[model samples]
Target: MEKFEALIGEMEEYGRSNHVPIINEKGMPVLLEMVRQKKPHRVLEIGTAIGYSALLIANNSADDVEIDTLELSQERADIARAYIDRSAYKDRIRIHIGDAGENILKLSGKYDFVFIDAAKGQYPDYFRKVYPLLTENAMVLADNVLFRGYVRGAAECPRRFKTIVKRLREYISLVSENNEFETVIREDGDGLAVSQRLPKENNR
Candidate 1:
């Protein structure tokens, strides 16, 4: 927890300028483990809020690995760019200024790892867009699927957010039920859904 607190402190001190979303250290350590184990050459991140997660992944990965992050907000992108430029990880991370939904379609390279932390309501759409870009054995890590427990207690959520929550629930359910991939839904910090792309032969 100390490491998480330290990360939070750093975010408070400098990341506020970029509106960086705070992450729980619990999920971060696991994410880093996944990156190290996978040793992905290319990583795609759908959201670049302050680029904290992207930086963390890069720091834990091989030096040759590269991270491409998409961020729609110019202000946040600028702040993320500044932070990356000043940090030792500047060379490994590249930020794209545009909506992830449309921008991801234009991306040509295959990705071994995809991290989704964008608009909660758009996660399913993100998955659909990213599916074709993933290489065999690729992994997609979707964050905040549990919506801080609100997902289970749908009756308790507010009217506006309830729809988003329902959508996320559906997305998780659909992914978990799909035989093409093996999905793991873990309850840690807002909940993380990990889906690994199965080999083509495994589909049948």
Candidate 2:
């Protein structure tokens, strides 16, 4: 436990110095709690930023859990791979290097838990692509849905980020309004949307 804590501290320092986006402090507890409650056997992560969140998920999940993580940047993927290789959960975590949108489609098998922390503008597309791959009662957690509080009210958002903010709102709306999902938007750490797919029988 001490070793794991030290590693997490090092990763957090690296994220700060390198300006890499990582899960915030508030989001960490939420993520860990979800992993504890769900105990998902299969987990999918859209963005593996230096493998920080991937490690978190792996550490909190059951021993036999399999994690598939995607990173668009080869440089980042290499760094993440190195980190994963040093961790205790190395054998279970697989890092895929490619465009997430294309890679998500190529992925086979269903996932019991999914974490989305990739491109803000493509959240809707990612959700749609992953929907069919979710197992019954699967949980989908999207990070940064409220991009720096811009998605809530775009009037104060910068022109360049308006598109992303608009798309995020749309993504949240789609999840919230979907009949098969029970969605909750949490204000912790840039905002998180936790959505659970209802079973077929329950939906009717």
Candidate 3:
């Protein structure tokens, strides 16, 4: 475990230097704790940016956990695959390169744990696609949902990011309003929306 932690530190440094977005330290503990408590058998991650978060999940999860991660950019996917191969959880993690929406539909088995950290604007669509694949009591965590706090405030955001902010607001509302799910918005890191699918009996 010490060796893995060291490797994760190295990866974090690499991500910072390379300008690749990875999970922040504040958000790491939240994810780690969720994995520890959930003990999910199958985990799904939407963004495979350099594989930092995916590796983190794999390292913290049970030995039998299977992780499927998606990446849109082939270049990024290559780098992520290399990093994952060097990790102890390499065999348990699978990197799927392509659009997340399409690849998500191709997944066969249901996942009890899902982490979404991909394009901020596509979060609602991703949620729709992954919703059907979630098992009872499944946990779906969406990272960067707050988008640097712009989603909550009226502060002027850059024109390029306004659409993303708008979509994220919609996504948050959709999840929070859904009766089948219970959602909590955490202020860790950029922001995280930790949602759990309610049992059929409890949905009412």
Q: All candidates' lDDT scores?
A: 0.82, 0.91, 0.91
Using TM-score as the measure, name the better of candidate 1 and candidate 3.
3
Q: Candidate 1, which segments miss by more than 4 Å at Cα?
A: 1-9, 16-19
lDDT of 1 by residue, 95-146 (tens): 9998899999988889999989889999988988888998988988888898
Ranking, lDDT, top scorer first: 2, 3, 1
In model 3, the worst 10-residue window by lDDT is 1-10
lDDT of 3 at 151: 93
Evaluation by TM-score, superior candidate among 1 and 2: 2
TM-score of each model, in listed order: 0.88, 0.96, 0.96
Per-residue lDDT for 52-155 in model 3, tens only? 99988887777799999999999999998888888788889999999999999999989999999999999999999999999989999999988988999778
Q: Ten consecutive residues with minimal summed lDDT in candidate 2?
A: 1-10
lDDT for model 1 comes to 0.82
Question: Could you tell me which residue pairs clash in candidate 2?
Answer: none
What shift in Å separates residue 96 of candidate 3 from its native position after superposition?
Answer: 0.4
**Model 3 global lDDT (CA atoms, 0 to 1):** 0.91
lDDT measured at residue 90 in model 1 versus the true structure, 0 to 100? 81
